[model samples]
Structures are given as structure tokens and as C-alpha cells.
Target: MTTMARDPKGYYAVLGLDPEADAEAIRAAYRQRVKVVHPDRDPSTRAREEFRRLMEAYAVLKDVIRRAEYDGVAPAEAGGESDFTPMPVACGTCGSLTAQPRYVVFRTVRSYLIWAKLGRLDGIFCRDCADHAAARASIVSWLWGWWSLPGLILTPFALLANLFGGSKPRRENTRILLRQARAFLGRGDLVLARSLAEQAATFARGPDDRARVAALLRATDGAVSGHHRRLKSRWRPGGRVFLAQALPLLALPVTIAIFVLIAIRPWDQPVSTVAPIAVHPATVGEIRHVAVDGLKLRMAPLPGAPVLTLLDRFTTVEVNAATASPDWVGVRTPAGIEGYVETRALYAGSGSRFKTEWCSDNRGAPPTAGEILSRRVSGDHRLLVHNDGRRDGVVKLKTLAGSTVLSVYVPATFHIGVGGIPDGTYRIEYATGTRYSRGCALFIDEMQASVLPMTVTFHYQSPTATRSLTNIAEVWLSPQSGTVPRPLPLPPDRFAADD
Candidate 1:
């Protein structure tokens, strides 16, 4: 290797070339120097000396053998080789001499509301390289750095800097360029970082260097581009962001209006009119049935006592046995109204009017009555009848309260009755058997007195026995007035006496 002497008048210095310049570089330098100091352009004596020196430098450097021999003798002749040695503080990429303790200012935009000075990078970069590094850093800062209101407001200035910033110097070594690119990346200048990384790959010296540079380029490209894509997606207008910002503002008025309306509306207005229910004071056992509507319940057991409430038909009451009177009964209405009502207005037990009938085994035959062995009136207008041992009997009872019909199955010589009857006339109907039978009779028993007791008898005849005993198959009864008695729709086997 031909090395130049570290002196002012050395041939390399005369041609403005480095000691490591190749033959081609020496020729090019000669040509450029001849243009600057050629006699045709400059007639000065100093120009002629400079021109001669440039020719001499090129002549020795252009020939390989001559340059080698000259280099060997020139360093010693110029006073030993140590003075000519290059400093370690040179740009690894451009190979340009640099001073130590150089500083670079790094600025980053942290967010839309923040701009941060990230301090300085300390290294040995030449002026041109330093400018390039700063430009690349700024580009990355603007591209990927956190954005703030201030940074966003000053985005135009940063863009201008990126577009017309210092140009990057040409580099020969991939490693140096990669180092700077990484520095720019650290500063958040992804665009400039990527550009430098790609340039580094192109300048790579070997396959290994090239592969490393290529990998770096790919990584930078993927990461930076992916990050940029994410940022763009996040800041995209409309959709969820718009709805999130808009819904609360729109709903505020609606919510307020709803509350105001609720607050102002009349809440005390009556929704319904309810007549007060009058409760009556009475004993637990004195249960009285309501026989008619408009039956006034008084506050005391007297006609002149103030009326507390009225009673409806079939409404039950608990009579105050201790307050019983001849003409009035102290009753507690279903509403718990403690008062008095006329004795005729309420009946004992259930106030249900029933239609009853007696039937025989022979269908469609007019029913006849046989002798009643024993008959008595029980509580609540109930009739208990013991029949002579002659036939199977059935008593069908239908209530006026509703379509509630009951069939009593009476075997031969059995006892049965009808109960829960209101104070009303009832027409009794019956069916005859195959033997001599008597016609049906109607009987009315009024339960005016509380302790009224009664018995009943009916006559019948048979040709063979001429006896009063006979089998009674069925019986029927209905109110004598107001509503006519309808035909009993009895089931064919409903009245069959269970053996």
C-alpha cells in the first residue's frame, strides 16, 4: 500500500486527495486541479506553481510501481510515518475526518400536545453527516413520535424541514449508515431511518454485511409501516369515535326533558273512585247471609241508628251474637263494617236459592212421592228426610246463585236432604215408579224464628201392599214465582243409587 506523508507540500495534498486515493481518483483530481490553475485560465505565477505541483502529484500516483516506491520513501523523507497516521475519529460511512466531542440536538414530538427535546447524541460525525443525521431524526420524529396539540399546530414547519433539510452524504460502509439509521429510528424519524437503512444495504461490502443490512431494512419497513397503519386507523374519522363523542351530548337534553316532565306532571290526581267498604261488628258464629241488595247496615241495632253501609244479595256477615235483638242483628259486613241490619235483610248461613227435583228409575215419568218416615229442618234451610224401605231415590238440587247442581244418591231405605235455600217458594217435582205411586206435593217452610223445628209427611199407595212405604227415585224443586223452572238436564246415570 502506498501511503502519503503527513506534510503540507505532499503530492496527495497538492492534488487535494487522500493518501488512500486510487489511480482513477488521482487522475480525476489532476483533471479538476488543472481546470482550476491552468495557465490558460490564470496567468499568475502562483497559479503556474500550483499547476506544476498538480501534474507532479498525478504522475507519481497514476503508475502503480512508481506510486508504491514513492510512497515507501516519501513518509520517511517527510520525517517518519507517525505524523501521517489518520485519526480514529473519522466517519465510518463516508470516511470523512471528524473532530471528537461533537454534539447533535435531537428533538421529538411526544404527542399532539407535547414536544420534547430528547437531548443530544455524542459522537464523531462530520458537519455534513451531522446535518443528515438531524434531518433523518426530524423526519422520524414527525412521522412516528407522539403527537400533541403544539406539535400538530407546528406540523407544517416540521414538514418543511423534512422536505428541504440537509442532504445525506454518500457512504461506503454499511455499518456506519446502519448505526446512523438506528439513531434516527431511536429519535422516531421512521421515514428517514428507513431511507438510510435501504441506502446502507446498497452500500454493503459483502454477502454477510448485505444480509444484515437487508434484514435491518425489512424490520424497519415492517415495524414503521405497521405502526403508521395503526395510527391512521385509530385516528380515522366517523364510526365509533364520532358516536362516542356525540351520543352523550345528544342524550343529555333528552334525559333532562324526561326528568322535568316527570317532575311537573300531576301525581296526586286520583286514578279511581273507590266507595268505602263498611265493616260490621259481630260474633264469629253468628254468620248471616245477605238476602237482598240495598240492605243497610246501621251503626247500632236500631232503625233510627245511623246507617254505616249497605249489603248486597248473597254477601255473608258475621253476626254479633251478644248484640242480638228481636228486630235487628248486629253484623260485621264482609268489609269489616261493625253495624246493625234488619233481621229480614239477612238470613242465617248461605243465602243461596235453589231449584230442586225428585226423580225415579223410570225416565220421563211424572215423579210421585212416597211416605216420609221422618223429616226435619236443619240449619240453613236444610231438610233431612228418612224414607221408608221401598226404593232407590235421588234428589237433584240446583242453586240460583249459579249453575251449581247437586245429585244426592239415596239407596233403598236411606236418608237425604236439600240445604242452603233462601227464603223463596219452591215447586217440588218428582217421577213415579212401576208400582202404584202418589202425586208430588209442595211444602213451604219459613225460617222466621231462629229455633223453628218441623216435620214432614207424604202419602202413597200400592195395589199389592196398600202400604205407605215406597221407593223414591228423585226429587226436584224451584222458586214458585219470578223465574220459571227450567227442565233439569240431569245425566242419565247421575241419579243411579250407588249400591
Candidate 2:
């Protein structure tokens, strides 16, 4: 019933019929169109004219002789009432002939969030093949098309259109039908040729169409009948067809469930306690001193192995034997705990006697425990630094702009009070080691620097009208446990750059 904008003067167009429209389609279209444009019911000039054209179209198309004449096909060439044979072409799916062949393109759409794609299958097919193709395309679209923005809007419409016979060739050309009929006739396929000729007679409109279909049908009628093969449905397994139709619908939900289970495993793992390493008796090699504070004695050679205990600087450990990993050495601590420590953390001699090239320099005498090595400006605010560990360190105070405004040297078991600090926020950074490098102005060996997590503020205020108070910040250079904030490690190059 959809209004078609085909040729305005054409009889088929007047009734919204294509050249391929059969008797029933033509009648149905005429009935649907006539109700709206009936001249008697609606007294208008346009309605009267439309009604006249509709009647003319119906009169000619309804009668066999008159319709053939209007289409310019000979009534003799147009088969009789009992000789009905629709267009017969070699079915694309099967080699046998089909009376009704339609050119159809089934479309499918898929979406992946940001992108979308359109797919189609084009063929001149019979009813069964066309249905199969449309079913597959529609199923795939329904499963995947709703995932993206464009597909959500287009997929539903596409599926609906595909379900209803899909789309056919836009232009009607009976010449192609005539040519196919002639080819079949030449090949002595009388049954197929006659069927094609009959279909052509319905659509033939011009001198060329009329001449070709009449000659083909005449030859087919005169030719001797050949082997006739009736059209049958394409052979396909029922189970496979059902599976193919159903799998895509089930696949999406199954795949999503699998992905979700993989992403969030809700199962609990079995719990077990770690067993302690068995102690073995072995000859101890020369004693090695722990060169660094807070050195970890691990149960295995790996850096991430469980820590047996922490070794303080200058703590002595008995070297048992070399482990497979050269970086790690097997040793027994003073507490009889057997473990492995990094080779770099062990010195053959005492901490004071450990020597290196960078440690030998004496460019400037080392500062006293509480001496301020350098000061950019002076103020009443003060900072107290305590080094309770057995390692000497130099602490530097830098402003937010990265300027090193103050530096202090705090030795082992020594506390320092750095005064004359200006009233501003400052970051506390420090380096610790055994030997002080005067040349490098930093600890040379076993050197470690860190920036404290908390910044110190030196805000001065008048407690009363006449009494003034200066803020003081106190800190311990040793690492603290529990809820206390830990200092973040800093690269030696970055720490030395300020000095």
C-alpha cells in the first residue's frame, strides 16, 4: 500500500504496481489505492482524475488479453490460464530451475562502541535461499548491532526491512529476462525458457521488450520438451541450521559471563603458614661488618625474600658460604639467625676503616654535629635534628622553589639545633653513610638520601602584645615504625645538586 513514485503515466505506477507484480499483487494494490481516490466518494478534480487512471490500470491488468496488449506482449505468447509459469532462472543456491527468482540483498550491521559496519549478501535467489540468508543476517544484527550509537538506531530498522523480502533491484528491465530466456531456449531448455518468456510478457512495455519476448516464447513453444526438473528446497541439516540460527543469540550472553568470571574470581584460596628454615652447622669464614643501617637479612638470595631481621651498621655477622647468586652472601647473625645479605652491604673491615676513592678527599673540614654548614638568610625560627643511629648524615632544608636555604651535619648519637631559619615552608632532605666525602660534599659509600614526607613551617608570631614566639620543628633522622610518616628515597644526583 506504500505510495510509489514510479512513472506517473504508466498503468502499473497508477496502481502502485511494479512490472514484476503478479495478478494478486496488482489487484491488492488497486483495491488499496482506489479507496482513497474514489471519485464518487470524494468530489474533487484530482480524485476524479486519479480514479479514472486507477480504473484504466485495473481494467487492462485484470484481463489477460488486454493486459498483454497494454504491456505490448502478444496474447498468444502470454501463456494461458492453466499454462502459468513465473520467471524461471537457474537457482543460485541449487543448479535446478525455479519459477520464482527474485534478486535480493540482505543486510546486517555490527557495532563496537566507537565504530560500526554494514554487511550484505547479494544474489538472485529462490524463496528458500532468500529466507535462509535473511534469517542469518537478521540474527547476527540482533546479537551485535545494539552495542554502539549508530547501530542502536539503524539495526532495528534494518532487521525489519530484511524480514519483509529485503530489497530488490531498483530498476525493472524485462530485457535481461528476455535475454535469459533466449539463452535457455538456445540451450534447448524448453520448460525454463517458456517460464521466463511468460514472466517477460507480463513486464514487457516497449518495442524491444515486445519483440524479444514474443520471438523467444514462439521458439520455446515450438521446441521439443527436454528433461524437466522441479525446484526443491536447498538440502541442509536440520540440527546444523537450528544451531547456526541459535548460536549467535546464545554466544553473546555466554561470552559476557565468561569474561565477568575471569575478571572477578570470587573463589577463596587455601590458607597455610610458612615453615621456618632449618638451621645447619657450617664453618664460619672471616667476619664481615654490616656497612649500612637497616640492612635486611633475607631467608633466601632474592631481594624480595622474607626478612629474617634488620642488621644495624657495624653489626658483625659470620659468613657461612657463598650462595648461588653472586650478589647475595650466606651469613649467620649474632642472634644465631641464618640468612642471606647483599654482598654490597658487607665490608671486610670495620666501618671506620672502609676506603674508597671518593671518600679520601678532604676539600673542606667536616662540620660539627650541630653546626649549620650553609645559611642563605637568618631568622628567629629553629630546627632540631637528632641522629640516634650509628651513621653520620647531612640534612638540607630547601624552599618550595627548590632553593637550598640551610644545611646541617648531624653525626652518630648526636643531635643538632639549626637556628636563624627564615619564616617559610621548607622540605627536609638528608643523606646518610659511614664515610663523609668532602670533595663530593656528600656521603660517598653506602649513601642514601631521602625527602621527608612532611614539610616544616617556620611561622613567627607574637604570643602577646610584647612577647614574640618562633616556631620550632623537631625530627629524628632514623627510620620510625608504626603510623609515623616515612621519608621517600631520593636519587643521589638530585640530593647532591642542591649542595
Candidate 3:
């Protein structure tokens, strides 16, 4: 097993484990680690940071040689500088043999040609790579935490020396790898360095990816040792306290040192200059089609007090608010239907009861026809709209063109403020005329891509209860439709009354 380094900032301390912890003890510590640090289980960031360290340390110790090399280093020393030796021969990024290989990076790519023959490269993340990335993310998240020790910042990368993400190098050859790395790093021989680093990486048990990473790192470091300067300073007085920060950097050896240190700290989201969006107000004609328990709503506007009738499955409805009494919400059906029904089976909170109206998966309720038809709302006053119907994966909304059109992406939910649209109905038209249906024409007067910054406020914290939390996120909104409509570039001012 590997011995803990004199580098007080190393992985051993990060996990609070003894350098000599055995496999069973390590496993036991790991279980405890999961309980405290797993993001799904814990609310605090410190636990997650600690967990990454544990994973890293276990990776190195599981190997024989790497562990030995690690143990060989003095515990009080920063980065084993006294043990390091320089090399003379050159190693390339991709190569056969050399005296020194500063680092190596293996990239996996995929490619597909248009009904052609042989292809070259493409971009893909293997399962191990993805997992390592996720684990790395957890460490980064923990470091950039609201309440974390600065010492915890760089430890994750060092710990990563333990994993290539769930994939383990053959345990049998662990000593061989360590022997090679020691020889290579101590003397800086390209051929020897590459060989030893490769061996060390190959024998890594978990996420270390030592050989693969070293090959890449060798080239980048290029005999330049200053990157390790902070590591050197870390060995000074009171250095033990910051060892956690400095040691991890030596393992990963990337230029992200300062950024990572800062990122692993806490941050508050900045408020946007734009105002929050609002839901649409309900109307009469849109709520005609709601049918429940023999209560059928008309699809079109009718005189007030139309007799209550039998409910049908086709009947749609909307509501101004949630159900509290008998637990029913007003729906606007496909036929412009409206009225109240059992809330248990229906969605809640809509201002409009219009059928065939537009709505966003992001929205809490259905919207009105004008609201659905109109898109690209002004964030300055928080665009308002209502949910029209329950059509899964369907984003139906009206545009200023006065036609009931569908959007390319899922529409977000909205609630209207006290005031109505400043100008009731703005007209829109197509510059390119896209075909959405057998007979409908699609337009893109002001088509563009945008992802709105949204937040979900939950009422409770434990298990996502019906309550709301103050947390928010910048949601990515993009086009599901392939093309953007051309611009008509018009206002009432563009056309005269005589024209």
C-alpha cells in the first residue's frame, strides 16, 4: 500500500485516512465518505470535497509501486523536489520512443461521412471519461462552495491521480508503473520517462489515468519547472495547513490552479437586468371546451349562463388559480372550451380557458390565443401568456401575425401582471413562409435563439415538496425547428393608412 506523503496537503489528509489504511479499512472509509459527500445525499459542499479526496487517495494506494513512490517522498516536503531528476531527450505529443516525455493526451473521436467511405475522427466521451468528469465537477463544485476551507480547493485534481473514472489499471503491474515513473521523473529521460509514466498509469487501480495524463503533461511542462513553484512554497512554515491545496495541483499539473481555487468557493448568482415574465389573464372564449362529469364546455364564446352539461374527455379548460374547494380547475379545451373540473386529474393555475392555445412546458398553466400566437415577448415588462391544452412535447403559441402558430421549442410558463398588453394585437407575417401543417403558413419576422434564465423556487427542501425554494438557474433554450423565419421588419409605422 502507498504511504502518506510528507506533503501535508496531499490526498491522505484530504480523506482523513491513515496512509497505511488497508483495503478493508479503505473500503469502510469509502462507505462513510459516500454518506457524507454524495451530492444526492448531502446538502453541504465540504462533504463532497472530502469524498473526492477519498476517491483519489484510494486510487493511488491500491497500486503497489505508485503507493511506494508516494510513500518514499517525505511527509513534510511539498512536491518531492529533492527526489526529482532532469531528462535530456525529447518526446513528442504522439510518438514511438524518446528520452523524456513530459506528458501524453489520448483523445477519442468519432466521424460519419455523407454516404461515403472511410472516416477519420469524431468527438465522444467514454463512460470512464464522463464519470471522471462528473467526479471532477463535484470537486470543483465543493471547492467553489459558500463555506469551505481554502485548503480544499486544489485537492480534487491531486486526488484524481487516483482515478480515470471507475476504470482500474491492472493491479498486478502496479509496481512496474511506479518504478518507471520514479525512474523517469527522477532523471528526465524521454524514453525512460515515457516508459515509466506509461507503466505507472497502466497499473493505476481507479481514476489515476497516470500514464495517459503524464504523456500529455510531459509535453506541456517541457522541462519548465516553475509551475511547481507554488508547490515549493507550500513546503515553507505553516505550509502543512495549505498542503491540501498545493499537493493536488502537482498531481493534475494544469494551469487552472488559480481559477480552480476560486471556483471551488461559494458564489451568488447575479440578478438580471430584465424583469420576470408573467402569466396571461384568463378570457371567456378560450374556456368553452372544458368537460367533466357530464359538464361539456362550448368551443366558442357563448352567452353567459349556458346550461351546465355532461363532461367529455375532449373538453379542455383553464383556471385563474389552483383548486382549493372541491379541488377543480377551469380548463380551455381544443374547441375553445372552458369551465371547472376535478383538480386531481388536471393541471392548475391558468388565466385563459381557450382551447388550442399555446403553452410552455416551463409554464404552470395554459395561455390565450393571442398570447400563444405572439412570441419574442419584451422582458422589460415580463411577457404574459396562458396555457391552452395538455399536449405533451407540444409548444403551441400565437405570434403577432394574428395566426395561432406553434414554436420550435417548449414554451415557458407565465403569469400576467395587473396591466394588460400595452397594444392589444400586433400583426406578424412570414418572409419565407414555412409549412407547419397541410395548409398553415409559418413565418419568422424576428426569429432568433435564446435561453431564458429561470429559477424554480420550491416550498420545501427535503424531498421536493409542493412548496417553493429560492434557487434559480440559467435554462438553455434553443430551436427544435430547423430554420429561422426571415424578417418582415414592420410596424404600423411601416405601412400608411392609405396603403
Candidate 4:
């Protein structure tokens, strides 16, 4: 026989008997204690003491009346037997004896690895409180679970645990709440019905319960609609809703007036005074250079005509006549070889002529081509061409000897470097293909190296066909001079052109 320890307090404690142990429990405990501490088998002083204590505990606990008397005297001892008690406990919230305390265990990753059991003791609630608690917890889980990324993963588990893991009360409470909602609906108390339906939905434990509550909520919604319609029908024009609806209508006229004021305001605009571009009258001149290298002198004005000879820059040529087409000029080379060359490829003394009637800036005679040419003999020059208004044109630069230096297409504004034309005088020209009703202004800035800058302004209008005009700008710089010149300001002119 195995010997056991003696209890210090009393006979009940000696046998490990709770003060409230019944006769059957007392008898069973006595048998188990005696076998462990039988004096005959364990011949020791401690065994004798254990055996005696066990017998004494059995004597007092076997009788119901005796156990009750002992419990009354030592009430603290009753706590030890609380877990084994078959009787129900009063609910913490409902004050009902139907609540039974139960332990709910959860197996988590940490618990599994440590071979540990983690649990919480909750009320073994009666159907009502259990359902209410479960429903409340499930509602919380649903409302807050999706707030975080991790929550989305954990929420279903939390919701399921709250709804069905511990008690069945949540399911029952949902049914009760739904029935109440329906009763309110039948009585035509729509607000109360909707409120109850919503609450029932929150507590619903399963999909089927939730679906039924959803149907109830829908029915209550219909009743709510009818109630709202009645309220609307009775509302007066002076009421808040009526005023809110009328506000937008009242604001429309004011908005229209503001836009009208903006549209009709008078704007002070300048008048345009650009003259139409006329072709320069034909005059004898030499080909100082070709604007494009390897220019071919063709027998006829058309591109596919037979090539008479290939011409390079500074080739001497004599102008015979101006063609109906402004692009081709009839000329004869010093070799007596007659051919047609592009008008843009040569510099001639036939300076541009402007219609005097359209001259906006008649302040002084427009600078002559010769005057502009004299200034370019010695240095580098920067040419800035600004086209005002909607008109567009191409501007070209060539040596007075007829060597084409640069050509730039201008839609609005353009700048070109005349520095490459070896410190000599060159002609500046502008032409447009399209006819314009108003006309456009051209502003030229001649920045000559080591010389005062000169600005010339011309107003051009092409009332009919494409026209070409040429003038002089001086560039004075040695071929080795790498200096960059800046464009001068445009002279004042009386044409308003879009930038």
C-alpha cells in the first residue's frame, strides 16, 4: 500500500474530501485514501497518521447532516468543491440560476508548440444571456474585423468562435429578436420594427438566420417608406426639406448673370497696319552664293527640266527677267549659259517694294537695302524675326554677292546667326505663300559684331499669291571669330500679331 500525506486542517482535508462532498463521494474517497495509506502495509509513523486521518474524514463526510454542519462552520472550505458542484450558478448579468460556469479552451500556435492549454471560464449562461453575449461579440467582430489587412483574415475565425464555440445563446436570441421585429411590423410601428430587425441581424449566428433577418428588415423598410411618404405629403413649403430643394433653382439666375457680365466686357484692341508683300522689280545682279549647296541650274523653271549646269556658292550670274512664279528667276551665267535659278539663290539690287497705302509706320522712309548692306561689311550679326498675327513666312539670308548663307522657316518668331557669312554684307528677305486679309508684321534685329545694333520693322500682307522680298543686313566678323551676338529689340510698328 502507498502512504499519503496527512491534511492539517480537518478530517475532510485529510481524505481530500470537500466539505460539501455527499455520502457516495465520501465513501469513494475513503476507499482510495485507505489503499494509499494503509497502516498494515506501511509500517511508519507518517503512514499511521495518514490512515487515521482518512478514517476520521470518512466518518464525518459520509453523513449528509454532518457534512452540512462542517460546511456552515468553515465556509471557505466550500470554494474547493465549487468546480465539482452539480448545482447551477446565478448569471452575472441576468441574476438567474440558469447560468453554469464553463471553460472555453483555445489551441493557438503558441499553445500547440508549448503543449499548453489556454482557456477562459465563461458563464454557462441560460439560453438568453449566452445568446446575447455571443451576438454582441459577433457584432463587434464583424464591425471591426475588416478595419485592417490582417483583420480581414482573422475576422471569420473570431466571428465563428463568438457565434458557436462556447454557447448556443446567440442563435436563440436572434430568433427572439426577429420575432419581436415581426410583431412590431404587424402593429405598424415601422421605426421600432426596423430597429429590432437590425439588432436581430447583428446577433444572427448563421447564414440562414441572417437571411431570415434580412427579409424582415426588407419588410420593415417598406413600412418605413410608407411612413416617409405620409410625412412628405403633409410637409409645408416653408419646411426645411422644401427650402433645400428650392435653393439650387434660386441660385441659377445669379450664376447666369455673372457669366453674362464676363462675356460682354469691352476689350481695347489695337488696329493692324501691315502692307501687302510685292515682288522686287527685276534688276541685273550676280549670284554671290547658293543658299543650298550643289544647286543645279536647269534649262526650264520646272524641277524635272534638264539640268544645264551645277552651280556653287558665289557663282556670277545676270538676271534677265522675273518669272510669273516668284520661286524661279530667269538668269544667264557669266559663261553665257542661260538657265533658270531659284530667286532665293541670288542677291540682287531690286529691293522690296511695299504698297504705301498700308504703311503703318511711315515715320521715315523704310531703310534701303544698300543702307543695310553697308553696315554688315565688317562683323558678326544676329538676326531676329518676329512674325506678328496669324501670318507665317520663310526668311532667307544671302551675301550681297549672291551667296545664300541661311534660310529659316518662320511660323511665328525666328532667330538666325549671320556670323558664318565671312564678315560681309547680306540681304534679308521674307515671303509667304498664303494670302491674309489683315496682314502680318515682321521685326528684324541686326546685331553686328563691334558695331551698333540696327532694328528694322516691316508690315507685310499677301493679298493674292505667294510673294518674296529681300533687304540688307550687315555682319562684320572675321571667319575665325567665334563670338555670339544677341538679338536687339523690335522697332515699334502698328500691327498687332499673335506671338
76-181 in candidate 4: lDDT tens per residue?
Answer: 3443644221212233345454212222221111122224222222433444554555555545554554555556555555544543444334665465456556
Report the error of model 2 at residue 319, Å: 19
Query: In order, what lDDT does every prediction score?
Result: 0.47, 0.69, 0.36, 0.47
**TM-score for predicted model 4 compared with the true structure:** 0.19
Backbone clashes for every candidate come to: 45, 0, 114, 25
Give one digit per residue, the lDDT tens place, for model 3 in 142-259. Answer: 3442133332433343333322322232543344344444556555444444444444554565555555446534643643443332111111222232344335545554646657
Please tell me which model should have the higher TM-score, number 1 or number 4.
Answer: 4
C-alpha lDDT (0 to 100) for residue 70 of candidate 4 = 37
Off by over 4 Å in 2: 1-42, 45-49, 52-100, 103-105, 108-499
Residue 67 error for model 1, in Å?
71
Once fitted onto the true fold, the runs of candidate 1 whose alpha carbons sit more than 4 angstroms away are 1-221, 225-227, 231-296, 299-457, 460-465, 468-499
- Candidate 1 contains a number of clashing pairs equal to 45
The Cα error of candidate 1 at residue 161, in Å, is 54
**Per-model TM-score versus the true fold:** 0.17, 0.28, 0.20, 0.19
Off by over 4 Å in 3: 1-88, 93-105, 114-499
Q: Which stretches of candidate 4 lie over 4 Å from their true place?
A: 1-87, 99-122, 165-499
Worst 10 residues of 2 by lDDT: 266-275
Better of 1 and 3 by TM-score: 3
